[model samples]
Target chain A: MILAPQALLSAQQQIQRDLHSCLDYFDLPHPLKDAVHHAVMLGGKRVRPALVYASAQLDGDVMSAAARRAAVAVELIHCYSLTHDDLPCMDNDELRRGQPTCHVAYGEATALLAGDILQSMAFEVLGSRMFDTADLPNPAIALRQMQLLATASSKMVCGQVLDLQAEGQSIDQSHLENIHRNKTGALIQAAIMLGATTVLPVAHPSFTHLRIFGQSLGLAFQVQDDILDITADTEVLGKTAGKDIQVQKSTYPALLGLDAAQVYAQQLHDQALEALQQVTGNTQPLQDVTQFLLHRQS
Target chain B: MILAPQALLSAQQQIQRDLHSCLDYFDLPHPLKDAVHHAVMLGGKRVRPALVYASAQLDGDVMSAAARRAAVAVELIHCYSLTHDDLPCMDNDELRRGQPTCHVAYGEATALLAGDILQSMAFEVLGSRMFDTADLPNPAIALRQMQLLATASSKMVCGQVLDLQAEGQSIDQSHLENIHRNKTGALIQAAIMLGATTVLPVAHPSFTHLRIFGQSLGLAFQVQDDILDITADTEVLGKTAGKDIQVQKSTYPALLGLDAAQVYAQQLHDQALEALQQVTGNTQPLQDVTQFLLHRQS
Candidate 1:
């Protein structure tokens, strides 16, 4: 059963609310806090956290506080990465999520600190009692989940470093895949796993299915993002279009052409849906999420 | 009882070995792996990790694996921060711990990635089985400990930001103190707390005492470092002396005068020893660590 459009939008809104509240707790110095607060306020799809909430729900822990906190954790990490990635030292874009990039609104140093604070705060929020009541196994399970998030964040950073290294290089598809897999795929997969892991103690057997769903969804999300980089309007995307070309970044569209990229995204989306089969819950939201990831306009 | 000199040296050497072995499992990029190997070879007193080992031993979790891994985690975080602290975007120091700093030896990009890898590896080491063997609470406790480390690391980054911001400014004592506390003191305190937190459960009563000890030790270390900036010879310190003055960044020595700075360090050292009073067990190593933090020649 596919989730109704209204229902999916509502879920996305709820995740965004929680994400906004969680980000509000961070207090950095001066205009940097304002810059970060504004950056988050501009708001992306909240897709990563939504997937977390959606997948955890499928595993029987749907909308639990633990799931929400983990969702928020993954999203904060993602936002932090975006802020840093857009800095002059890296991709150097002046806009993001449809607003001035962090460094453009704030100085480079403050922007750097803001991202660092958000990254650390994400772990703090997840480890706190906000989700402590989520019927998850003792603190150990929560700790393991947080550890996984950190691993994902680290991989993302490594990917950023590699991406920075790859600029202007005539890289092949494999290298490009490695970069995105580490950069985007790691966090996306972590977001899904973070949601699913909350149901682990009670639904231990379903992890493999959730992992498959997460892995496929993560790759599909990246492919769509690559497509957006080439196809979306700057006003609609809220960031500079043709950034892939400007930075000379190798993307699926760049390597495989836009049409082939679409086919690849569809295949990954189908794999994501097939992975949802092992679970016996309402798979509607999961279906919608897969479709939204692959087919969304911006 | 004060630990015999040989005993302290032996413990430090052992920690170096364990930390080296921890990195052995990671198949990192060449320059990164090579830079870290070079960093570990820098024969600075492993003061922070020693404090960890000493405090855990003082807390009577003697023969505990938690003590050792916690030691490794703290030191790795220390090394990671140092590697980045020396980056051109930050301190831009060309030398550290006697040899060329990470950025100087391996281009700035690799140095940054190396710092990142080391940071991730610190959490990984903490979450590994070696730290879990002593019936440590749950992954929650370990995760919380890691979170605490992250918080400190973030604070250190903030401090670095503050220090960088203060460059060329007419900073007073309070501002200097804030900079040192955030940049240097936070991690020092973390070293002590990481050691204690590992042995006791997350909610243990002793954490506060260990925190005080860490705070005092951290301040003492920073003041002593400031004192060294003026008093220690370049050859002895293995870095340029009076670089702080050269940069015009305010420091304890700059604010308090040389004699006053020495007195301030003594006060902090005593406070650290006093803070250790709440813990039961052998007190010698902890005392030595405090002394080492304050009065080490190099």
Candidate 2:
């Protein structure tokens, strides 16, 4: 059966339902809840969550309760990061995904608290009930997943710190790679790992192969993001385009030239596909995800 | 026989060592690591960590790796809350524990990220290895603890939201109670519950009684804090004194007369001890801690 790149739209809708159900379970103060909803429900591409189930090799339309928890967990972390990053003190963006940013819609303080609580909610979901299949769900899986999420979350923050410190400075390619690898790459790898964890033990050889696939794909995705920032207009991008250059951020185009960066992106894409080839199980979803990421416009 | 209030001094030292060791385990970027260390290490009274061990009813000097995790987790959350609460947009306090606030010591962005990362670190610590004694460590215990902590942490943020909204408004005692219950009482209850989880199951009778003890003590502690803010100087308080009144916040002393607030504090203290009486374990440490909380001048 040919799966023409697992339907990201389907995964997006399913994740929205999962996220809505999770939010409905809690009754927060009105403003806080509204802010959280605005921040989360305004919605992005749901690429990370889609990657989660894809890496798990689940059918595009099927749901694993365990994988749902992980998908929600990563999405929450991603949403919260965006909210806080949009704060006046951080990236200071006024819009995200074609809507007023969280801080702009809700005041900065509300947005900050909303972001902070979303993070706690992520762990709450993850540490709760696991896959129903594990008659007695293993604690180690949750522990290992929590550890991975925390580490990635930490690295992501570290990357931001590096980004903030490196602003306005011309840095080399190596430093630039280090920054993206953590800033965006860490969480991307984490999403893939969490999904893989749903089916594989921590020591499985497939994990080794999966990690390489995640690493290469993550960089390739960032490289595409860089390319789009220069190529796409704000209307198409749903955010202010050319932001990387505006902020004087060191990007692939800036360091390696647009031509070399495009070539590098293709190289990374090929590398990612090669790594996935080593993994067993229905690797089709991941393969589709990799191909989709390499060619996505926004 | 008597534990001298379970020697909060000792717990503070051990938790400090534990936190320092945790920090040393990671080689974070220089500025971020420094910010985290400053936020975690510039030491508060360690009241929450002390409560963790006190509720566990362990010998003052003895260490349980299990209880230690709970202790560290709550402390990390408390520290991060303080760091965020002290932000210019929030409380705007420059001094904490008689030193510069995190935002003041580090830049606002770095301080924000530090507080943010400290939260992830808390779950990282909690969801990792469990008690050394559990032949096969149970995931339920960690899940329960994480849920309690997350819930309490969420409530605390809500309380802050309410408090922010209540600024410049004349609120009733019950409203103030609602605010304090979420902000301070929830976490206090969580600490007691987490410590109890170390030695007791979820449905243990002692947990019910211990919760009441925690509720009353939490209120009493906040009531005492209100009294201290009104009566103490900045030097003694280590934070801005009389600032609550300056900000027109509704406090116990603000709603009730100072003399009446003191009377109410004593009544709450008595109520706390009354609840502790129903517990069957080594109640001495808890009793001592409650008494210490009642009389503590700072």
In terms of TM-score, how similar is model 2 to the real structure? 0.94
DockQ for the candidate 2 complex? 0.64
Chain B TM-score, model 2, reads 0.94
Model 1 off-target regions past 4 Å? A1-4, A59-62, A131-137, A164-172, B1-4, B30-32, B35-43, B59-63, B130-137, B168-175, B201-205
**Candidate 2 structure quality by residue, lDDT tens digits, A1-298:** 1233546767888899989988886678869999999989987788899889887763243556778888999999999999999998998999799999998998988998998898988887776663344543356776667777888888889889998888899999889888889899999999999998878766889888888888888889899999989988898788889888989998999989999999999999999999988987888877777777877777
Candidate 2 per-residue lDDT, tens place, B1-298, comes to 1233437767778788888877876667969999999999987778888889888873343556768888888998999899999998788899999999999989899889998988988887786653354543356777677778878888888888888889999889999999999999999989988888878766888888888989999999999999999888999789999999899999998789999999999999999889899987787777777887888777
Which one is best on DockQ? 2
Listed in order, each prediction's TM-score against the native is: 0.90, 0.94
Alpha-carbon shift of residue A232 in model 2 (angstroms) = 1.0
Total clashes for model 1: 3
